[model samples]
Target chain A: MAFFEAKNITKFFGGLAAVNGVNFRVEQGQTYGLIGPNGSGKTTIFNLINGYFPLTTGEIYFGGRKISGLKTYRICQEGIGRTFQVVKPLKRMTVLDNVVASAFLRTRSKREAVRLAEETIAFCGLTAHKDKLAKSLPIASRKRLEITRALATKPKLLLLDETAAGLNPSEVDEAIRLIRKINESGITIIIVEHIMKVIMTISDRILAINHGMVIAEGTPAEVASNHEVVAAYLGEDYDAQS
Target chain B: MKQYSGAILLLAVMLVFPLAVQDAYYQHLMILVLLWVAIGSGWNLISGYAGQVLFGAAAFFGVGAYTAALLSHKLGISAWWGLPLGAVITFALALPFGWVCFRLRGPYFALATLALNEIFRHIATIWESLTEGMVGILVMQTFVSKVPYYYIALGIAVASVLTVEIVVRSRWGYYFVSIREDQDAAESLGIDTLRYKSVALCLSSCMIGLAGALYTNYMGFIDPRVVFSLHDVSIAAILVGIIGGVGTVSGPAVGAFIMVAVMEIFRSGGFGFLGKLSSATGSPFVATLTKYISEAHVLSFGLLVIFVILYLPNGVVGDWPILKKKLLFWRRQATV
Candidate 1:
């Protein structure tokens, strides 16, 4: 059985199917990539998995437990953690406090929560800025803080939405390396990204969708070469011939 | 230890204030300040830390006040029992209210609390048999001297501040601030936003309710208009939080002191100093000016709130560094 599974998931926004009959599965320790053009429901799938909003009609199984109808925080407590597409830092809190807040999910002790937050902050290389308010961090550090907060929740599965969206090349590379490290630590990651290099290099398997329907799913190389995925997302002007 | 020295010193001064000053009038003013400390701390918890502005603190305050008054009027018990009972009842009231209204965020939630204040007032006014209607309920004052009441107010104030300090330092404190900063983010990270908000609201309600009970026991009378006045109780609570510093632990204490002093100053026309000048000079102009100032307390209070928002938006405690710098600059100029 897959570690995480979405079965025939469908969502309707007043007669429009934002996500329709989409199905995907992730192995226990794999990093999965989701890619599509704008409004292709990439983030919608992430939302559905995180239970941000109720699934109009679907079943989401994490560790074989149905989580589709659960509350967002309950879903997180069930070991699925997620980041927003637009960074949602606790703006008034110090970075350390932001992570400490997340760490409280697992432990009630302030000392333990702070200890976990400090470890996560160090792991994410945000120790230098831990004392600074979250709003003061630069964009790259803010994105890192997002991941750092999610990591501190100690999730079995992490959903990252556009983690490398606005970073420069070097920062993108750093994000990719951080993601690899996260996956190596035995956490399954489902990443949504528009940046081809970061997604192509990190994702062990890739799923391509368009108009809320799965266009292709295979190894990264296979999905990259699929004709329909090429036409719908990668653009036909660039040849699959190469 | 070093950080708490200032708080410790302030507390020591509060402990000695009523003892040092024999005048009943000044002690009354100090009691009002202490009462505001509780109310303002309650407001700060829900609105400042949890980021849910409560515009109707008088709902809880009035309920608490009535609880004490009704206990004496109907049950023939000591009104002092109202303190604990009022806290429990207010907690109960806030639980369901928060569950329903927390669905609405920001200004909408504030409007719902305002509606609650009005509802409570209307109920108290209409229910003549139970509440004595607009006639108001009167409780016998527990003590003839003001010192006992002063100490009780001080105890409530201390408890309120300590409650905030402990909650803000706990893991729950972080959760509250996280919810305030960003609700969705807090939820995404496994913080139960609604439950935590309910916790904050319930706590705030309990604190305000305690203050109300104290008010009834001390003041000996409470009309719906007096306890539930939107301007006097609700807005004053907000003013205390805002003028003190919204999320800071000790902000409410400072704000309560300033607000009570300002209100008294205007209400008394500079603590009767203007009246003295008017009578001494036998000047109609001075007498008229004093009367106008006394009557325009609310107007002047509103103007002060505007000034605070403009210049010290974070309140005195939150903007202390900026305030200290400005004061130091002035001091330096004076020396030069």
Candidate 2:
């Protein structure tokens, strides 16, 4: 049975449908990649699934329990943790504190939360920058801080939104490796990314969307060969093997 | 070790301030400083930490003062019970406003709070039968001297500062700061931003209400205009927080001291130098200054605000850490 499922998920802002009639499922501990063009609604789908926005019409199930329309914090308590595309770190707080804030949901004790936050910071290679304000970190490290913050919640299902957006090639490679390590730690992940190379390398299965509708869904190689996926990527001439 | 010792020394100095300044007038000024320090710090809890920036704090303060006055005069009750009752009512009154205002951002929310304060003032004024309208209520005041009031004010000040310190260092404080920094980010991190904000406002309103009760009993009066005046409730409290430090624990305390001292200096005829300047121009500039300055300290407060926001954005206490760091570096260079 699927650990999480979204059936006929539809979201409309005013009259325009931002995410139209989408269905997807993730098995326990599996890694899935969501790929789409600029307005393909990948982020919207993530928002709907994470309970950040209410679905105009549809249902979301987590751990075999219906979670649609639940408050965002309640959904987080149910073990669905997410990172934002824009990376909203607490500007006035230290990087360690940003992570510690997330860690508070798991444990109310300050000492325990600090310990977990420190461990998670080290895991994300952010120990050196722990005392620095979150706003002062470089982009890559800020992204990593966001990841560590989400990891601190100890969620069963993690949603990462464009985590590798502004990274250099080597940084993107490192992000992919860290993501796999997260999965190996018994957490399921659904990644929405535009970096094709990272997507193809790290994704066990791919779900592609265009104009708020699913265009293709399959294994990395299979989805790469699909005609709609090829057209969405600008042309068939673009190398998918990369 | 040095920082710890410095904190200890400061505490010692604070304990001696009342005793060293034996003049009744000087004691009165210190009492006012302690009062503002408590009320301003409480205001900072929701406005500074949660980023709500409420301008309706005076409304709660007035509500608490009136409630205590009415209970004591009309109902013949002690302030100890009246204080908590007044706080409960104010906290309840805050919920609907907080619920509606939380949805608004920046200027809109500020305007909402300001409007609410006006509405509260109007209600207190027109409800003359109960509130005594502008005539105000007065208690028997069997005690004559202002000395007892000073200690009472000081005790409340210490309590308020300690409460703020605890709330800020706790998990609730972290949640509030997170909400201030980024509301959407805080929500995603599993913080119920709306609930946290409401809770903070409740706690903040109660503290102000307690201060209000204390004020009414000390003055032995509760006039609508005096109780609901935004000058002391909003402007003074806000100026204290901003000038001292908006979010830091010591910011509001330091701000209260500076604001009280400056206002007292101006009020005590130190601006006589302006009289000499007026003799040359014959514009009655000194007269104009004395008249308006005596009426309301708003203009001077406004200028101070502009100066602080422009040059001292981080506030007084917020700069301590950075200044200490700079001083340490200079000392090292000198030794070398």
Candidate 3:
């Protein structure tokens, strides 16, 4: 059995199917990349997996146990942590406190949570901004804070939604390095990213989708070369010559 | 230890205040201030820290006051027992209310609480046999002197403030602030936002309920209009929280004092100075002005709220640095 599997998951907002018959699986210790255009249901799939929205039809399994119907927090407790596409920092709290809040999920002790949070902060190279309020941090730091918060939860599978969306090129490279470090710690990662370079470099397997349906699956080279994936990105007009 | 020295000194002053001022009128005002301390702290916990604005604190307040009044009137027991019993009942009330109302966010949740306040007021008024309706319930005073009431109110106020201090420093405090900041992020991080929100509501309800029971014991009377009043009890509680500081632990204490002092000053026409000035001057204009000042207490209170929101925004404790800088600007200028 796969480490994490979404079996025919579908979601409907009234007549519109936000996610229609989507299926994907992530093996243990693999970085799975999901790429698509805006409103292509990438974030919706994350929401469905975390139980933020109820699935219309399908099942999600984590470590061979069904997890689709569980509550969002319960899904997190099951070792699946996630970050938002739009960074959601606890604005009034300091960066350390923001991570400490997430660390509370693993341990009830405040001291322990602080210690864990400090480690995560140091690991993510946010030590300098640790005392600064989350709202006061720049967008790059906020994105890193988002990942740092999720990392502190000690998840086996981390779902990162657009962590590189608003980052500069150097900042994006730093994020890629941080993600690589997290994956090196034997944690599985499923990333939804717009930057093709980051996704191509980091993803062990890539799933390409369009209009809520899977267009291609299985690798940077394979998906990048696929005709449908090309059409999805550049539109249907595909000629050999420029 | 150094951080708590200020709090410890303040507590010492509060302990000696009633003894230092034996005047019954002054003691009564202090009692009101302390009662507000509890109510404001309770409001701060859920509304400020947890970020769930409770527009109907009067619902729990009225329930607590009636619990005491009814216990004394119908059950033939000391109204003092209402303190513990009222807290329990208010906890029971808050649990289900939070479960239902917490589903709604922001203004919608606030509106639901407002509806709850109105519902309780109607229940108290319509249930004449039980609550004595608008005629009100009058409980006999347990003590002729206000000293005991002063100490009791002080204890409750201190406990309420301490409760906020301890909780905000703990894991629960982090959870509450996270929920206030972003419910989705908190939930994504595995914090059950609903359960934590309910926890904050129940704790706050119990604190406010205790104050209500104390109010019944001290004031010796409670009508639906007085205890469950939207303008008086409910709005007064919000004003205390806001005027002090929304989420700061010490904000409510500072806010409660200012609110009670402002209301009393306006209601008593600057503690009778206007009345005295009018009589001394024997001028028609002064007399009319005095009367207007006394009658316009609520209006002045509204103006004070607007002023605080516009200038302080964060309440006294939260905006202390700004206040300190502005107040000491003259000293800095002189040094320069």
Candidate 4:
């Protein structure tokens, strides 16, 4: 049985559909990759699934329980944690505190929260920068902080939204390592990323979306070879070049 | 060690203040300082830490004061009951006010609070049958000695400051700051932004309301203009936050003392010291100087605010490092 499922999910902003008639599911402890061009409803699907935006139509189920239209925080309490494409760290807070805030959602004790935050910071390789304010960190570290904070929530299903958008090759590689470690911990992940290397390397299965609908869904190699996926995003000539 | 020492010394001074200062006028100024400390600390919690800049704290303050006054006027309840009752009433006001207003973020929410302040003021002034209108209510003071009021006010100040300190160091403080930094981020992380914001607002309104109740008990008078005045209650609260340090626990305490001192200096023309100096000299120049200083106190206060904004945007406690460095440099130059 699927651990998380979005069935025929649709979202309309005014009259236009931002996301339309999409269905996807993540098995327990699986890494699911969502790939799409700009404004193709990839993020919208994540938003809909995470309960950040109410679906205009269709239902989302987590372990057979319907979760559509639940408040974002309520969904989070049900064990879904998400990161933004644009990182939003508490500027006035230390990096440790950024994670501590999220940790408090699961634990009422400040000591436990701090301990969890510190452990997550170390896991994300941010222990050295723990005392530094979040706003002072460079983008690479800020991205790590975003992921660290999400990890602090101890979610069963984690959503990564463009987590590797603007990173150097080494930084992207580091993020991939962190992501794989996260997946190995028995937490399911759905990653929306523009980086092909990161997507192809870690994704057990890939879903390609375009114009608010799914174009292809399969194993990484299978989806990479799909004609519609090539035409929509991978480019028709990409096969010839290889 | 230095931080702990300064706080202990201040507490010691406050404990023996009424004893040391035999002058009733001086004792009154200290009482005002304590009252402002409670109000300022309340303002600091929601605005400085929570990032909800309230423009109408007077709404809750007035509610608390009126709650106390009405209890005495209508039910003949001991005015002291108003202290706790005011906190409850103000919390009631904040629940819906925060629910409706938290939807509007940043400055718009602030404006909503300001509007609430004005609305409360108008209600208090116009509700003749219930509030006795602008004519106000008069309560008998329980104590004429000023010592009881002084201690009670001091206790309130300490309690408020301690509450703010504890909240800022707790999980709620983190949630409040997170909401202020980015509500969307906070929500994404599973923080109920609205709930935490409501918590911060409730805490603030409750403290201010208690202060309001205390005011009525101490002064033996209640009027819409005095308790709910925009300039006195709301702006004064904001000014206290700015002057002390918006986000820090110690900022409001420092700010309250400074604000009260400055206000008294201007209001009483240097605690009537200027009047004595003018009379002693009896010179036209001295008398003219004294007249200008007393009459221009408000102008001077306005100028001081401008100076504070331009030079010390972070407030005295927040900018103490820079101030210390400057002071050290000046001392070195003087010795040279």
Mark the regions of model 3 whose C-alpha exceeds 4 Å error after superposition: A239-242, B330-336
Interface RMSD of each: 0.5, 0.8, 0.5, 0.7
* Model 1 Cα lDDT, one tens digit per residue, B97-208: 9999999999999999999999999999999989999999878886999999999999999999999999999988998999999999999999899999999999999999
Clash number for every model? 0, 0, 0, 0
**TM-scores vs. true structure, each candidate:** 0.99, 0.92, 0.98, 0.96
Cα distance off (Å), candidate 1, residue B271: 1.3
Off by over 4 Å in 2: A235-242, B1-8, B271-296, B321-336
TM-score of each model's chain B: 0.98, 0.86, 0.98, 0.97
Q: Which has the greatest DockQ?
A: 1
* lDDT agreement of model 2 with the native: 0.85
What value of lDDT does candidate 1 attain over all alpha carbons?
A: 0.95
Per-residue lDDT tens digits of candidate 3, residues B64-100?
Answer: 9999999999999999999999999999999999999
Q: Report per-candidate DockQ.
A: 0.95, 0.80, 0.93, 0.83
Q: Which stretches of candidate 1 lie over 4 Å from their true place?
A: A234-242
TM-score of chain A of 2: 0.96
Candidate 4, A76-152: lDDT as tens digits: 88899999898898998999999999999999999999999999999889999999999999999999999999999
Deviation (Å) of B113 in candidate 3: 0.7
At residue B250, candidate 2 shows an lDDT of 78
